[model samples]
Target: MDSFVYSVNATVPIFLVMILGGVIKKLNIIDDNFVNKANKYVFIVALPAMLFKDIAQSNVKKDFDISFVLFCMIVTTICFVAIWLLSELFMKDDTMKGSFIQGSFRSSAAILGLAFVQNMYSNTGMAPLMIVAAVPLYNIYSVIVLTFKAKKRNEDGSLIEVSNAENIKKACINIIKNPIIIAIFFGLWFSVLNIKFPVIIDKTITSVASTATPIALIVIGAGFEGRKAIKKIKPTIIGSVIKLILQAGIFLPIAIWMGFRNQELVSILIMLASPSTVSCYIMAKSMNNDEVLASSIIVLTTLFSSVTLTVWIFVLRMGGFI
Candidate 1:
């Protein structure tokens, strides 16, 4: 009961923040063009700043777990492959493949995973660093899917040519040049080198990085595309189940296998069950892979995660797992 209340309190503000995003959109305070501009700000500018600063500032000596990180990687990869194969086997057509498969594997750490952790622990910021790893992992997977794969028809499973290799190569190049990637690069570089950035430079980066969460939430809110989501709720729910259930199914057993402590298990479960990344949808849209379906999955999963997430939280709490 208490956890539910806490979850609700944490979730409600994000909804409000999203609404505030819409309000900002309407008021013209953020500029109508800001919608296009925002992708650059969060991905290119603010997010990188945050990543570098967080990784740079974090104490390198705190309860590190290479085993856990490796576990997450293997489990996530397994889930990704299982879903890609399963979703392909069960559902056909480019639209459906792109819609369902991406949602199955792509986890929204910034909004859902990071939010849950921050709610559980105020200002500790360790979770954000774990997210540095998640970024490259998420991108590499998404791009590979975008790059080489051709979608098959639902009726006959025939490959339909959509994108060219030149475009695909360009897309890969662009993804590699991502500001967040750059930030993560420098952040890790500093961490490995054990060098402290000057205080003023660190402060500047921190201030810019702080904009990421709010601006991201706002853009997320504005980009909800709920009417489209309503049209596709059934399929969207199916995608959400893949993300929430399938990932949890894989991760939970593995966590238990590793003799994970309760909080550790709960933390991984929450991350596994997070909504599909808006960034995935954005990439799919840019890559011309069922953008509407991707958007529907994003909005619906984000909505469903609010409820399913609360249920998971309670389950973990009751079982003394969280």
Candidate 2:
């Protein structure tokens, strides 16, 4: 009973905030322009600030577990490679192959993951470490699949083919330039060096950090397009199942066998099961992949994950895993 209540308390408010954002959008209180700008703010400023603050303030050197980090990296690599290979062999729609694979494997690790951990634990806990381990690979894998599978078109309606070598180079640049990864880098640096900011600067960072999760959730809600999503329902449901259920179902048991519990288990759960990040849609559209399908997967996964995540948390709690 306690576990169920805790699970509800932890997840319901987050989704409620998203629902509020949707309602606000319906009322035209927040427009696409607002959602776009707020998304940018969350991505480049608020989210980074939050991560920096959490990691920089934590006793990272003491808590750092190389084995745990390796497990995260290995699992991420396996899932990405496996999904992409399967998609290549099986998916009939070439345009959808990239979006399906990307949407299936890439999670909302930084945004929804951190929010859940913080809500339950009152701190970021193991999430920063998980982010450092898995997020770079997520972005790199996304770039590779999206680039190689992308169907580029000229303004005059001609196809443009990109070389594998060019795709590899672009993936490298994107991984290096990713803002969240950069923030994690600096956060680790600050923690290792025991760096301290001035009081005013620290407080300002705290304020900005505080806005990251809520605003990001709101932006996700406001940006959602239900009508666009319905067109891609078949692929959307498949991708969502892979994201919010199958990944966790397959890996959580393995993680248990490997002896992860509590904060570590929760972090792993979030990594494997959270909704497809909003960035998936942005990346698909930018790379000229199937943005419609990407949007559909995001919408479906985000909507379903509310209930699915709660169930996972309840089970985990009942089993004393978290």
Query: What is the per-residue lDDT of model 1 for residues 11-65, given as tens digits with 9 covering 90 to 100?
Result: 6665577678768777777764676578566766876786677666655345356
For candidate 2, write residues 44-88 as lDDT tens digits. 787778778877887678778998999999999999998888777
RMSD in angstroms between candidate 1 and the native structure over all alpha carbons: 4.6
Whole-model alpha-carbon lDDT for candidate 1 = 0.67
In candidate 1, the residue pairs with backbone N, CA or C atoms under 3 Å apart (3 or more residues apart, or in different chains) clash, namely none
What would the TM-scores of all predictions be? 0.81, 0.85
Q: List the residue pairs that clash in candidate 2.
A: none
* Model 1 segments more than 4 A misplaced: 23-32, 60-62, 111-115, 118-129, 148-175, 285-291
Highest TM-score scorer: 2
- In model 2, the runs with Cα more than 4 Å from the true position are 9-39, 118-124, 285-289, 317-320
Minimal lDDT window, size 10, model 2: 2-11
